[model samples]
Target: MFISFEGIDGSGKSTQARLLAEMLRLQGHDVVLTREPGGSPGAEEIRRLVLEGDPDRWSAETEILLFTAARRDHMERTVLPALAAGKIVITDRFADSTRMYQGLSRGDLRGIVDQLHGLMIGREPDLTFVIDMDPAKGLARAKGRNGHEERFEDFGEGLQSRMREGFLALAREFSGRCRVVDGDRAPEVVAEEIAEIARKSLAWTQKA
Candidate 1:
């Protein structure tokens, strides 16, 4: 099963992803827990350049391309191989993130983004969990944990709002495969809900 967790920063998507992977592992299922833009070595390097460098140094289109480049490396090296072995792959973020951050929020080179999506992960996640939350609150939670924010992390209110809208748009477009969970709830509750959703989705996918 290929599953992904998507949401704005500090929305607890990563935490839930880890928990879900652990739960599946406990069930005697092989699970690979990873994150995008840095899953593989080459992708990690690209991630550093994209996230830590001067924000003004790269244009929006450049930013989009960099993300897709990292994604290509990640999919070829990590994601596909694991899935081919019939293991559950849980990713913290994926191409949908690029569509939200660069395409909708930054309005960059979206044509290339779409092209890469088609060429790369033509088969989307068997199930996608979008942890929905208010952007301001999410940012605050993120800052609380990390102490400081990075370039993309500090998008401020305007960009954050747009990103939220972008996520919703993507969810609607892929309704059959996407599920939204309330991220404002307690962590344990969120995790339980996600686990149930994953179990049900896996069952349905297998039967189909």
Candidate 2:
């Protein structure tokens, strides 16, 4: 089984991803915890190029290509092999992020994003947890970290708001595998909910 955590910056998806991975590992599941743009050596290089620069450093079209390239490398080097070996893969973010950040944040270029995704990286997570949070709150949490990868956070609350909406819309669009979890509660509370859902998913997968 493959799982992905998606949300605006500081929505706690990363923490949730980690928690889920640890929990699953405790249950004797072989789990590979990774993140996009930095899962592989080649992808790690691209991560710095795209994530550490200025927000306007790359155009949306250019970002789409760059992200797709990184994702392809990540899949080839890390994701595919893990899944083939019968491990559960969990990633911090995935192509849904690209579909929002580069596709809708700038202009209506989802077509381009989708085209590239289908051509290069055709796999989607078997389960996706879209951690939902308020835009302003999410931005504040993100900025509080003072991390270097503030390129997207630097885009301001407006972009975060739009991205939040885009993610929610995306959940509806891909409802089959997407689950929206409110992130306003305490971390343990959120993690418990996610773990329960994940356990149910695992049981279903096994029965199938």
Candidate 3:
């Protein structure tokens, strides 16, 4: 089964992704934990370009292409192979990030985003956890992090707020595969909730 965790910056999506992978590993499942736009070697190179730079480094349309290219590389080199081997794949983020981030930064571009995804990367995770939290609180948490990947987090609280709404909308739009998890609690609490959701989702996917 494949699972993804997503949310605005500092919503603990990465941490929960890692924790869920670890928990599944402890349960004796072969679990592969990865993230985009840097899962494969080639994708990692693209990741550096997209994540670490001036915010306006690429035109919004150009940025979309870069992200789609990275995702294609990641799926071909990492995601598809692992899934073929019957392993659990958990990722920190996925195509939904593009839908939200690009839509926010470049104006309404959902049509183009969906078209590019449908044309190139044509699969969705069996389950997705959107760690819902307040934008201001999420920004405060992200503030402590230091890295070149600060581009998205640097969008400030205003953008983060909009992205939060976008994610919630997406969760509803993809209700069959997405779950919104409250992210205001302790990490342990959040991890437990996600693990349980993954457990149920995994069972359902396997049965199907």
lDDT leader: 2
- Cα-based TM-score, every candidate: 0.94, 0.99, 0.97
Give the poorly placed runs of model 2, Cα more than 4 Å off: none
What's the C-alpha lDDT at position 161 in model 2? 94
- Compare candidates 1 and 2 on lDDT and give the better one: 2
Model 1 pairs in collision: none
lDDT (C-alpha) at residue 5 in model 3: 87
| lDDT (0 to 1) per candidate | 0.85, 0.96, 0.90
After TM-score superposition, what is the CA distance of residue 51 in candidate 2 from its true location, in Å?
A: 0.8
* lDDT of model 1, residue 58: 78
The list of candidate 1 runs beyond 4 A from truth reads: 147-149
Q: Name the lDDT value of residue 171 in candidate 3.
A: 98
Clashing pairs for model 3 are none
Task: Arrange candidates by lDDT, descending.
Answer: 2, 3, 1
Model 1 Cα displacement at 2 (Å)? 0.5
Count of backbone collisions within predicted model 3: 0
lDDT of 2 by residue, 1-208 (tens): 9999999998999999999999999999999999987799999999999989788999999999999999999999999999999999999999999999999999999999999999999989999999999999999999999989999999999999999999999999999999999999999999999999999999999999
- Model 2's lDDT to the true fold? 0.96
